[model samples]
Target: MKKLNESLEVERIYTVLEERIEQELEERIELGCWMYCKEFCIMYS
Candidate 1:
């Protein structure tokens, strides 16, 4: 029972970490895309 509880806790922690990592990656990609668009606009204009 204790082992099961410990594994559940570990799984929750990993799940949270994975979610945070994915969020960060998404934000980074969005930022990169915005920057690229801005640069393109400036270059064309």
Candidate 2:
């Protein structure tokens, strides 16, 4: 029973970390896309 409780806690921690990582990745992707688009416009124009 104790082992099961510990495993559940670990799983919860992982879930939180996963969510944080996903959010960070999304922000980074958006920033990268914006930078790319800006550069492309400058080059083409």
- Compare the candidates by TM-score and give the number of the best one: 2
lDDT of 2 by residue, 1-45 (tens): 999999999999999999999999999999999999999999999
TM-score of each: 0.90, 0.94
Residue 43 error, candidate 1, Å? 0.6
- Candidate lDDT values, in order: 1.00, 1.00
29: Cα error in model 1, Å: 0.5
C-alpha lDDT of residue 9 in model 1: 100
Which 10-residue window of candidate 1 scores lowest in summed lDDT? 36-45
Please, what are the lDDT tens digits per residue for candidate 1 over residues 6-44?
A: 999999999999999999999999999999999999999
Off by over 4 Å in 2: none
TM-score between model 1 and native: 0.90
User: For residue 20, what is the lDDT in candidate 1?
Assistant: 100
